[model samples]
Target: MTVLLTGLPSAGKTSLATAARAALLAAGHRVEVLDGDVVRRELWPELGLSPEDRERNLTRIGSVALLLARNGIITIVAAIAPYAHSRAALRAAHAGVPFAEVHVATPVEVCRRRDVKGLYARQARGEITGLTGVDAVYEEPLTPDLRIDTTLEDVGESAARLVDFILHGPVLSSPHGGRECSGRF
Candidate 1:
């Protein structure tokens, strides 16, 4: 199973992924969180925030995620993934796996205000280029499996809901797995 959490910067994707990883571990599930920031700094150090670079980064992450899922590991990905086409490609690449897309639907204003990493501020000051939801574009997910409104829900609540969703299957599906996934968050 792979849970891909996507949103703009400061949208709590990392926090949610961390919480979900901890909860899944407590439930005796082998979970791994592949965070974008850490990946950018450590693995893809030469990659900048250009559109092509971002797509390359996502491709690398998606490849790792698919591999982990194939090996029965619950992979949690926390990435901005600002392009809808790339996200769709990822879903297609990992078809038939228990893939869930979680959109951290935090408002841009709120995110800018809570810019813990100062990304939004830096973009405002022209110090950072190609910032999602700021100088660059973030193509919002149109049919995400889970759309968490971070402005309304806290980290623990969001994590709990995600855990429930993962453990019990989609909220619209039955315990026997007889139904197709149809519900949206």
Candidate 2:
């Protein structure tokens, strides 16, 4: 299974993904977390967050995700993935795999409040450029497999819902219950 956790910066995407990854591992599942920030810097240093650059990065990540998913490893990808086209391309690339797209639907205000890195503050002060959900774009997924609002749910419960969905399929009472995934591993 390849789970793509997408949202704006500080949207709890990494926190939620980390929690879910832990639960999956404790449940005897092979799991790994591919954080976009860390992976890009170490693995794809030449790549960037520009539209074309992002698509290229996402493609590389998607390939890795497909490879792991086929080998029965649950790959958790926590990325802003701010472009809809990039996400669509990833999904299309892994057509047959157990792909779960989870949107950490925390609003920008909430994310700003939780910005431990001061990214929002930097952006506000004109110290940074191309910040997603700010100067740059962050296209939300139209029909994500799961939508979790961190503002309304704690990290543990959010992770539990994700675990339940992956293990037993989408539960009726999802965190936000906006849309249901067709199937999952």
Candidate 3:
């Protein structure tokens, strides 16, 4: 199974992925999280931050996720993946594999407020350019398998809902108020 968790820099994508990975591990499933930061640093350190570079990075990560899925491992990808075409292509390429997308739909304003890396600040200061959802385009997913809003729910609940979807199917608003489970959020 390959779970693609997409969101902006501070949208809690990595945090959600981490929590989901823990859930899978606790359930005795073999899972790995390929966070954008860790993948950039360890796998494709040479890749720049341009749109083209971001596409290339996502392509590489998608390949890795497919490989892990082929080996019967659940791979969780926490990446910005700001383009819809790239995500669509990746999902289309994985035939017969369990490929799911969970968009962490945190608003840009909320993301800016949660910017632990100070990326939004740097972009505002003109120290950076092509920031997704800012100067560059994000091309938000129109129909993701699930969508979680960090501004509405915390990381743990988001992950639990995601893991539930991965293990079963959509929960359709569990008693825990997972509107995300209904694929409406």
lDDT against the true structure, per candidate, is: 0.82, 0.80, 0.82
What's the lDDT of the predicted structure labeled candidate 3?
0.82
Query: How do the residues 1-185 of candidate 3 rate in per-residue lDDT, one tens digit apiece?
Result: 88888888888888888888999999999999999878988988999988888989999998999999989999999999999999887887677777877788888998888887899999999999888899999988888878787776667777888888888875322212223642211
Runs of candidate 3 exceeding 4 Å displacement: 170-185
On residues 39-104, what C-alpha lDDT tens digit does candidate 1 reach at each position?
889998999888999999999999998899899899999999999898888877887777877778
Candidates' TM-scores? 0.90, 0.90, 0.91
Candidate RMSDs in Å, in order, are 4.6, 4.8, 4.5
Q: For model 3, where is the 10-residue window of minimal lDDT?
A: 170-179
Question: In terms of TM-score, how similar is model 2 to the real structure?
Answer: 0.90
Can you write out model 2's per-residue Cα lDDT over 1-185, one digit (the tens) per residue? 88888988998878878888999998899998888888889998999778888778778888888899889898989988989878877877776677877888878888788886899999889899998897888998877878777776588888888788778775322223245322111
Each candidate: how many clashes? 0, 0, 0
Clashing pairs in 2: none
Q: Top model by TM-score, which number?
A: 3
- Model 1 TM-score (2 dp): 0.90
